[model samples]
Target: MCRGWCWGCGWCCWAWWGRSPPSCRRCSTTGRWIICRPVPIRRGWRRSRSSCPGARRPSWCLCITGTVGSVPPIGRPPPLRSPRSGSGIGWSPSRGGVPAEDGATLMYPVASNGPGTDEKLRDAFVERVREVARSRGGLTVEVGGPGALAADAGKVYESLGGPLLYTTVGVVAVLLILIYRSPVLWLVPLVVAGVADFLSMGVAYGLNQAFGTSVSGQSSAMMTILVFGAGTDYALLLVSRYREELRRVERPYEAMKVALRGCGPAVLASSGTVAAGLLCLLAADLNSSRGMGPLGMVGVLCALLAMLTLLPATLVLLGRRVFWPLVPAYGSEPKARRSLFSAMGSSAGRRPLTVLAGGAVLLGALALGTLDLPGSLKQEDSFVDRPESVAAMRTLAEAFPGQGTQPISVITPAGRTEATIAGIQGHEGVAAVERGRTGDGWTELSVIAKGAPQSAAETATIESLRDRLPESYIGGPSAEQLDLKDTNARDRLVVVPIVLLSVLLILVALLRSLVAPLLLVVAVVAVWAASLGIGGLVFGPVFGFEGTDPGLGLLSFVFLVALGVDYGIFLMHRMREESLAGAEPAAAALTALRTTGGVIASAGLVLAATFAVLLNMGLVQLVELGFVIAVGVLLDTFLVRTYLVTSASVALGRKVWWPGRLSREPAGPVEQPPGETPPSRERVAVG
Candidate 1:
């Protein structure tokens, strides 16, 4: 039974199932109103009869919007039968004295009991509204959910920023302070790095804005690291030479010019190789990978410019103030004490083939890990904690019967038979399904799965579903996600080769020797293998980190191969200079190591320390990347540079620069050659 009240109408009514009697007349009386309250019927329902003189049948039409004073007795409250007379019993519904029945509309019947009937009615109401909306103008709805790409990018940036910047800048600052012990010297590299960073970021921003390309946050973090490490390394090389020249030469400006003339090409060549290596990223289809290519290239270029232009200008202005508090004696000669690196270089030069073979075997064994590396795009692997959203997702999974809130969408043509949807429900691993219509006569099905969304098993199931889906129905999200995975995999294969080729080309251009560039490639590849293998062994076995993040592998490959070449360049350039001075192979190697060894080692320390800071990041990807790069630089500087290159130069002898026609004969005794002073016994001659 249902009841309602009409305020100000002062009317109520009830209906009898089978009879009209005298009490019904009360509803029709002039200048009066009637109230007949509802009463529940029992079983097959029977009603009691009452006779009256002015009889009128109870209205078959029951008005639901009226007050029911009581229900009729029959296992229910008795229905109230109010009088039509004036006074307290009956009042005119209208203030002007009209009867309530005179202004009433037709009544409708309402059912009040059933199981699951409410849900059916709600569905019907919603469908009706949707139909009405469709009849007007078609509405469009988003297929999946909101895109979180930007937020994910932001997280990458935040994760990498703190450690890379602070550690690298701090380490370089301390190293510079130690070397010169002067405020100006300590600040020079920092200032130069700042300028390089500004130029790189500005150019990248302009390029992205103009081309409508997006740079990954990871690339930005890498750029920051590159700018500091590369900028400082170049600055140190130039400044060291500048300082040495200042002590020996009378004119500070001429010393600066001499320093530029000697170190400029070497710095440019090193930066060129690094930049070329970064350009390999362009071959990747993944936006993150591609973005890194240009971003890294820009950083190297900026560092190059700062070293060549801004650094020299600043040095010229500072003059001998660069080493003020610790000024050298009137004419300081190069230090004679042998360093550990020089000694190592001497030993390796004496046993070139043995050193090369031993280093090659060790690096080759480490490279084996690369073959066993796994690639997956699980979100857990990307972030530090599973993230709050991912945690909430797990909670939702527990609450539901299936794999939380991850949804796989199935799309089909509208007007599909119900049998088709039933078939989809019967598919393996499908937990539940919801159906809705899309415009243009299409239907969308949201299928819930029983396991983690996007897992290998789930992906397999999705693939099976794609293959098994009825010709009339189609797979949407499941199929598309798989396609994205395949595309990324293909992109990796294509990109890695392209990057390798680009690096080779750059090496040839910088070294101007086909043999040297080829050998350089071999050394870099060895470093890459060794670094990654060590990372795998350490991160997986010792630290309990899971499989390597794919992004880490790609970024690490570029960084290790490209940045690692810096040490090789330093060692080779010095060796070439010493060799051209006509020293014997062993003596030349020792001289090269003794001259450039300290600066290269210092550069390696600064770069490695900077990368090591990434260990503090929460994400395993950063940890892997940080340690891999740090280890690669250390290996390159200490082992490859001091041992391998020195050994090769000795063994190859005059063949090291073969086909270039550089003479092996020593430049005869030091001649004043006009204005220059001949070196005294206190000063060792260097060409």
Candidate 2:
């Protein structure tokens, strides 16, 4: 007998009772009569009397016919039809019937010969499973199954990438057009920047593919901004100088050559410093940060190469048309002090401390915002709005309470017989435990944190879990993040010293002054700290941003040092030129400002505007970074260029270029010698 009820095709029955019952079928002794009765039906069915019409007339005698076959019983109802077979029931008394004295019940089991029961049931089960699989799309069988966190991140990233890139590029172009004024001049920097971007990305892709290196999404976006802003800056400097030279030289190629020769070293030095600063990221522990080190260095290298090679070539090809229609032709020396910029510089030089103090106080006020900075690293916080990932996260949160995010795996050795996994279930801050099998005799446990996956609290929880685990268990987010954090901490120490050393080396090479690079380093450090302090105040307090992005600090340090040195070189070069003209200390400072101030300010504005495009990105890190560097450039150009260097040069007088014996002796109130009119009406180069 089957353990449960059996349905044969469409007929349902109690299999055991139907075949071996004493109550239903019977056999007779005389003439071998037999009879079988149908199972009972619902109350509404009527019994047919046609089989035994003469019922009461010795009905027991007819049962004595000695038959042994299926037949209806005497004085009982006829059998019912089989539903699946669609056959009528007919019982023959000659075949089998029952007699009162015989008292024997005959049972015949129903058999299925075609399309057997097991085959039909198996086919039905398979069909049901197929329906379920089709409905589900087999996603549960594949990686990143439906509604997975990784899949969600992928979708959100793609959606944001398009609009964010568009917004950033559009903002950069518009801002450049506004700052440069000339449409023709605007395209040159952008074109150089575009080439640099492509080359950097290509190199990064190759490195990632070849060396198994990968930059984070945030860093990739930043590389784009860095190349654009830095590229444009280098181009602007060279072109501005080239324009100035075009007016002085007869041939355009000569002017181009002079511009490249003069600006080439400065550009190389600046790019080198920036690249070195980025290489400092290699000291970072986080894979993302470490990846950025090489990625950023590559971008700076490309920008520098473009500035040195492509830029010079393009200038040689374009000639005067590079500036177009607005070329500065032959003219008398410009009246330096009469220009609005020179007057401002002269006023600034007169009250250097006041300008310095005012700038310092303003930066100090903004630096107050740093106090409110939060340290949470929630993924939603990385994006501008609550993106689709956020919505999906909400859905997941609602569906599964306390299943916040992916857990960090804490692996313990199976060989450690003293270790027990039971303790992990009770670990503080661990919400759930998923046991995973390693190779033979090894095991791992995933300890899900109680909050957002990437939050500082979660990171802390992971650390705490690591501490709680037995020494046998290796614990952390992944081996990768742990290595990254270590790299970052170590890098922080190594990068600064290397950068400082590199900057000093470059300055020493350029100026041959031991004292000059030291002063420059101090100024760069002061400006960098002040910029970060100001950024902290704005983003941390007013905007409710986190601590300054680690990348931003690293990148800004490089920019401030390298680019700051460029300004230093320009100022010192002009001062040297003025000294050769036999000017007094104060007069030379005035002359340097009057000659280089406009170009420096314009170049700084263009660079700052370009960097500001990063603010349009969705990442808060980029926003903080964009503002910080933009402000840094402005300070370097306006305050540092106009006051600090000028005032220092004035105080030092003839001693500013000391030891190298570069500065001319102070000649008191000397008149302009022949062919050396007080740069009152001279035409300087403009790119």
Candidate 3:
């Protein structure tokens, strides 16, 4: 009972299409002349009782083209019998059409009642088609429509489900092994995060069943990825701090307590910001976008719970031997080594203004790549790997030069049906029209356009129809995509500022300085732009993508600005702590960067790699999203957070924390660390 236009994204539009009279005489097949009229798939229809000139009965075949939302009803109807002859079957059909090879002989063009888009119904139809095809010897009966495509897409997802899970687990295990350098230690984070992931799924399922929240392949994939990624991040921060605390506290449980106390605020803040920012998507009118908010929040919160509660508990139970070979001995200072962050800090400290200006210029320049970005992606181009639906559409495009294969449905109030149909017929782009099911107070009108689906002329016609028939809800796959595009634009105006303002407000509260929060916000926002710009440059040339997804900018912006601030929180909090402990501003900046740099770097690598897994998905949108977020994390890690932020802090000194108590208390010259020698003309000072 799918009454009108429905969409599973704008990737494919489905409709039944064929050409032939509703019912023709079988004897007429001998004649050259033939005509097609719109046929209804309803239970009863009038048909002429006649035989073709050469045949005893009418011969006919039905062909269809569309996605899951529509399909023709199964089996030919019984011939109409005259009231005087109850035993007589009276209508005849022509079976004179030539074999359809590469769509060479297609003359008739119309659709019948399609199998409508529903998971179970589509599955059943596809199964039935499969039996028919097999009996006829390998797809001899071509039901070229979206049912096959929808059925295949479902199968693809089912096939991919197991492998995608294994891939995520495998990647997480290997990365944790590399990071921990311990056989036993790596297992803890993986096991805990995996549990959290499983729990999130249960919770998501409950939400769907209880609240009727939308759940789809896209939303579920994003949810699982976020859990593994952000969970690992919280784990890294806690574990790193725990290791450092172990050297001072002597006991494992005591050390865990100390580490949690030290890093809890930052971890809490980081997860909170991500959750709040994702929740902003609830404002989107699109169901996919709206549903993702709760899924993402569930993922983040589940990860946070695991990291804070389960992660620590597991580590405490494992004891210090978890680190085995590299266990931190009590009362020993960590080996003094000049790491990359130390060198970077020294460089930025020496020439803060130069580093800041150069990084800013680089970001701005990369952002110029937006000019090269292509237009919006078409439905056929939405997937990285073309599915059966897209292949069918492509075949039809080649077969029919200038006709629409899919239907654009206009569902109007029953009272205005005539007026709506009249207005639609008067539209410039229409090729044909058919009246469909009437249910409730609505009448369904299916329209075939003169232009191909999703073309400019068709797009204009859709808009024109909407304007002319205001009482109708005009929709289909193409129309849904059009609505998606418009909604994304509207969301940006409303949601982007909320995201920025939300992050800004959080940062200001955490740092207690308008200038410092402003700097971090501006830096991350630039990172977002630079990341998208990088996507623009590579999506077309390197990846051979058709065009950028419309939702790309908004999703990427939210993630980068929100998640990008995680490292900032870790670094700036440490810097503030050091400044409060009586260190000079420059020394505090350098010390904070040197101490937290490795942990933040490792966290970024884990988060970025986790997102990079999305590249393996079939959808081009996911690939683009994965690529941009991964690239942005690396850029934020190696460039912005490490260099630009530190440099700015070094240059601004005490003023970076303006209006805060630390700023007023700091005035001393930068002091060298203990055992460091004074600088000379030949050597650069290390503070």
lDDT of 3 by residue, 33-145 (tens): 11111111111111111111111211112233332122223433333333332333322222223223454423222222332323434444455544443353212234344
Clashing pairs in 1: 4-66, 20-57, 22-55, 71-77, 71-78, 71-79, 72-77, 72-78, 72-79, 582-666
- Candidates in descending TM-score order: 3, 1, 2
Better of 1 and 3 by lDDT: 3
Q: Report the lDDT tens digits of candidate 1 across residue range 340-364.
A: 6657776786678999889888888
The model with the greater TM-score, 1 or 3, is 3
Clashes of each: 10, 45, 23
Comparing 1 and 2 on lDDT, the stronger one: 1
| Candidate 2 per-residue C-alpha lDDT over 1-687 given as tens digits, one digit per residue, 9 for 90 to 100 | 121112121111222232232311222111011111111221111111122122110000111112333233322224334454443322222223212223332211111111211222322322332233234331221111111222333333334445555665666677567655676767766666666665665566557657755465556666666777677767767777777666667676666777776667767766776776667666554555667677778777877766766666666666666565465675424333456557876876687667656765665665565554455334444545444434434433443344334445554555542354666667666676655444344554545567654555566666665567545343332322343344545656766677788778777777666666676676677677777777765775577764445456666776677667767666666666576556776777788787777667766776677677667665666677778888888887877677777776676666766666554454333364332334333334332
Q: Model 2: which ten-residue window has the lowest total lDDT?
A: 55-64
TM-score of each: 0.70, 0.68, 0.80
**What would the TM-score be for candidate 2 when compared with the true structure?**
0.68
